[model samples]
Target chain A: MTNAIEVTGLRKAYGSVQAVKGIDFYVERGKLFAFLGPNGAGKSTTIDILCTFLRPDAGTVRIGAYRLGEEDRQIRGMIGAVFQDGLLDPLLTVEENLRLRGGFYDLRGRALTQAVEDIMKQVGVSDLRRRPYGKLSGGQRRRCDIARALVHAPEILFLDEPTTGLDPQTRKSVWQTLHGIQREKGMTVFLTTHYMEEAAAADYVLVMDHGEIAAKGTPSQLKDAYARDKLILVCHDTARTAARLREKGLACTETADTLELPLASTLDALPIIQDLREEIRDFEVIRGTMDDAFLAIAGEAIRE
Target chain B: MMGFALRNLKVFFRDKAAVFFSLLSTFIIIGLYALFLGDVWTSNYEGVPGIRYLMDSWIIAGLLTATSVTATMGAFGIMVEDRGKKVVKDFVVSPLQRRSMVGGYVLSAVTVGVVMSVVTVVLGEVYIVINGGDWLGASELCQVLGLILLSTLTNSAMVFFVVTFFSSTNAFATASTIIGTVIGFLTGIYLPIGSLPETVQWVVKLFPPSHAAALFRQVMMAEPMAEAFATAPAQTADAFREMMGVQLVFGSTEMPAWGSLLVLLATALLFYGLSVVVLSRKAR
Candidate 1:
């Protein structure tokens, strides 16, 4: 299958300040792709250029077979975007906002109404359809924004910081809904996020810094290549657990809450968990994370 | 384009404060004319036949002309709000063409201007009749309606041009205030054009909506004007009409109705063309 998005030598600058330095990347079709970076790392500039909102100084961008400069209108019909800011009209109801967005794609009358209904249901905002957008909670508003973008059923959906400012529960719920929609529709989900855990869900990740690609790989590949693993034991008394583990000739670091034991290999995980099962309230083999991998590769945290 | 235009209209009407504020200038002008300006203008024409009707029609004509400008400015407020709120980016990235987006805004402003102007005309006629003035005949009413359309086109295009320079609601609101206050002076609503200095009278003549106001006054005040000046000399009535700007005079030549119509049409075309260029450039 053709890639959902393709770019070569993509470059954009605001006057003397270069927002997106020359870069190259492609997102595979029907995959969850995350562009990970901190603020001012050109994540938005790259997305804006890809979504046809900003004109690049130099590049060839092809979104689902439509060239960026020449076939923008066609490309627009094939892609949807949920920006960092709320695009829904606060004065309008959820249904009205969806209907308005649908109209932009030329859906009208019964067809437009049905699309709004289906999308509202899909995003679990069906009950909020009659409520004014301003009256919705933060989580509800983000869901409505996603629903608005989905009204046209674009082949690829770009979400820029989709879960920013959301509570942990709401963020998890939003991700679950996104995954369901992506799986059901086989839509290419391209997103940029500040949270490394969010990027962990991507089939592929591109870590960017200073307008350049710092690293690109699957989450596991990134972790394996750059990060280290450890064993975490949570208990009521971490000092007691650490002493007991130390007596068994297994060394561990004791923090106020947990004992962190280094793991040389996965083969050692089960033996340790079985040995410490009685003393520890919780025992788990901790794999290296995308956050660890990102720090390892960039030599700095994703967020300052 | 119609979809976007309808969305703009919906957004405008949904915000009751914005709707009231858009017509706020028109209401103020009407209030002043009824309470204070009416008495002063009537006193000037004391002992003259049909003074009440003539002065009432004069003020109503100016109000109708002012309606197009103020309402259109209010309509453009939606565009500014969309941009300020960043909702415009959604449309920018949509399948909608840039021209269609601009067309939506321009069309909605014209629609709002025309609609509000019609309401003003209805209310104005009612007020005039209550004050011993006459209702416009059907033919004259049709002529007045046609003038409103042209005036709205000119107003919408011109306001859209100014609005393109702003991307913040605060800035747009400030512009609306400035335009609302200045429109009366430019259209000779606050005082008769002849009463201003000669240079200012020329400025009024050159103002775009002033021609539309002159056109509306010609149709609205025609009967009352004839009755008020029936015993006066032909030159006296013509001079009074020109002085008050019910008729525009260029040096020695008194401009015919078509001359004012041509000026309005030219204003509409010029500003519309300019705004399209500005919007196209901004779209990129």
Candidate 2:
């Protein structure tokens, strides 16, 4: 019924470079909103301004019921953030780190202890509570980082590229954990990421490029408007297959091992597959994805 | 603010290496004095009654003053390390007030300065008594302890101001090394101010910790000083006290104990006000 975050004409600059330029967006409460952009885009800058880490040159921002600059303390109390860098003290144990972070929010004594235990358990890191933060694996440390931010039971969570350096399996598990927490707590999540599939899971997506919002919409809507599903054929000889398709006036792009023919509809796959017969080693009519939606809208692939 | 301050203290104490390195300069000064400088100074004052007591007290007082400066420098290193690793940003984004954050760091520095300086005083007293010197009386010991608090406040405030220019731990370490080497000369411990050129003596007199050192020696070495100069003419005893840096002389006017104490108090207040202004501006 209300917006979790609202911004209008938010602008920020560093010397000669404009990091965020007159951006406007609002995320609904209890929804997972993904902010997607390539390298050097304004995604991180926007998040920093919203989280009160950096002061914007000009803007009107409201987080829940609190104003950005004027009521920053209240806004900070309502939000939790996992920074792009490791914020945990390496020498401190996981439990010690959690308690210290809890102390920052003025949570202490039995109440602090209980909150720390509950958050650690909720993030599946209760068993690692006594372990030193430096000794934990990357995935484990991330779990602890998330648990630290959640100790205060913030109403909104800001995750800045939370899974950037994690391995694929670890990334997937973190995603699942994030989804689980969001679903269970019904807290608003504002995420910035370069992974399209991660953004694909969001109820709403905002794509930024070169300090401006290039596009914003739901995944399905963007896919319908700008992206098309492709019928991909992985063959022993994709060059010959591509030549054959081109002779028939069917436009297809060929890579080393596959030929990608954009399909207007799923029904078109039936005729193409039947005509190819034994020439096709393997084929699948893949559905449209946020990757395509992003490429079509942002005009560049997401840089790692 | 208390929680943040306590967290800093815990982090400093838990890191054995940091704790050791923070007091490393103090130990080095004492070690060098015991091995080489101690004999040289004692030989110069040979046959002066209670010379061992007076000279030992002088070096120990200087060491105590140095301890607060060096230990506070070490304590501020945590702030630099946290900034380098971006851990400070975590605090910035939290609900903690900016004043509280600055206050936490300032309080931690003061705590470290006082705690480590007290330990140094204990060690110095042990060494003095082993070398056949007497401990201070109740009133004298209270005066020494009171000076420790004021000296630590001044040192903490001064160091906090210096650290604001640094964000990287490596740069801060370099600054710490520079301070460690230069502070001895400024405080007139490495070389007595009377033996130096007049301009150099002026510099030492103007240095804040030099005043602290003067205050510490005045109270700590009073009994020994009285005994050593008991038979000498009043002017000669006054001259010896000035030469040894137990009393500060600017031109012909001798600075009284109250003057040095006032200088220390003013130094503490001025630097603390400047540090707060700088921290608040940076917060903005």
Candidate 3:
């Protein structure tokens, strides 16, 4: 089967400032892809182009079989987007908004009604269908937003910061819902997020910075390439413990109370911890996280 | 197009405050006319037969035109609210054409304008009859209805054009408040045209909605004025019509009823064309 989307040298600029400068990537069907970036890193501009809301300055894009500019309406028919804000009318009930969206795709009568009901049930929003969207709770509103996107049953769903403002428990629930939908329907999901832990859940990840792609790979591959595992030690004598580790050809940095060692991999921490048992009072071996890997690649921690 | 238009209408009517505020100016005018303006104007021709009926018909005609203008402006609030919240971006990304969405808003406003104007005319007629004026003849009522439809279309086009430049709800509110106050004077209801200075009277004549008011007055008050001034001279009635703005004169030329209708039609076309051009240019 063809890839869900493809873009080559996509570039978009507003006046003199370039928002997305000549980028290339593609998403396979049925894959969850995460595009990670800080503010002004061009993730939004790129997503805007992919969602057909913006035109690239110089590049070509193929969404399924249709070209971006030449066949935007057809692409619009095949994809849906959940924007960061104001995607649904606040005064309208959730069911009404979904029905309106379904009607926009030319679905009518029983089909539109059925689509709205099915999607609401799927997104766990059936009980809130009659509530005005503005009156919904935070988590309820987010689920309704997702249901709004699925009313037309688009093949690809583009989520822009889907869980940005939700609490941790709500965020986890939304992700579970997304994963369930992607698996059950074999739909492709493309999401951009500032939360590193969220990107760790994606099948593939692309990190962008300064209007360019800083890195792209699966979460494990990125962690392996750019992050390192750490072995931390609190001992009777922190200074002496560090010296003893350096004598064994293992480098360590000594804090006032602990000796820190960076290992080549998580398994490397086993032998080092075992060897330092006598000198250590307590120890912890911490594996690399998506945050650490991102910091290594972007040269700074992701800011909220 | 029809689906979106229906959505706009549903949203508008569902918001109870929107429906009430759209007719707010009409209610305010009726109250002011009864409380103070009524005694002042009717006192001039105290003993003239049918004078109260004539003045009542006259103010109601002006109120009908004012209703069309204000009600349509209120209906555009939905569009302005959507734009302010950036919900229009969602519609843009959908499969619907941008032109169709804009058409939906304009059509809904026209519907609201016509509905509000018709309600005003109905109530105004009842009030006139209660004041002892005879009901309009069949042909006269037909002419009045036709004028209401024309006035609504012209006002909708004009309102759409003006609303294009305002997206924030605060700006819309401020504009509405200003238009609500100014429309009364422009319709020559608050202050009669002949009583105003020569320059401001020119503004009242040039305004397209004022012409709608004139056309309405010509149809609605014709019989009552004729009866009231039967023993009086023709010059006396003509002068009274001119003073009260039952008819509008432009630069020493008395404009016929057809001339005012032409002005309404021409301004509607001009504004609609300008609106299309402005919208197309604004699009990427």
Clashes of each: 0, 0, 0
Ranking by TM-score: 3, 2, 1
Isolated chain B TM-score per model: 0.97, 0.97, 0.97
What is candidate 1's lDDT per residue for A160-226, written digit by digit as tens? 9999999999999999999999999999999899789988889999988888888999998888887
Q: Lowest summed lDDT over 10 consecutive residues: which window, candidate 1 chain B? A: B275-284
lDDT scores of the candidates, listed in order: 0.89, 0.89, 0.89
Can you write out model 2's per-residue Cα lDDT over A1-304, one digit (the tens) per residue? Answer: 7799999999999999998999999999999999988888888889989989899999899999989999999998889999877698888899999998898888979999999999998999999988989889999999999998899999999999999899999999988888899999999999988788888889999989989999999988888777898898987678888888999999998777988899987788999999997798898898888888888887755454
How big is the positional error of residue B189 in model 2, measured in Å on the Cα after superposition? 0.7
DockQ of 2: 0.77
Please tell me the TM-score of chain A for candidate 2: 0.90
Q: Give the per-residue lDDT of model 1 (tens digit) for B21-67.
A: 99988988988887898899889878999898898899889998888
- What's the TM-score of every candidate structure? 0.92, 0.95, 0.96
Q: Model 1 chain A, poorest ten-residue lDDT window? A: A295-304
Please write out the lDDT profile of model 3 over residues A194-215, one tens digit for every residue. 7988889899999988788999
lDDT of 3: 0.89
Q: Looking at candidate 2, what is the lDDT of residue A11?
A: 96
- lDDT per residue, candidate 3, B195-243, as tens digits? 9999999999999999999999999998998899999998988899899
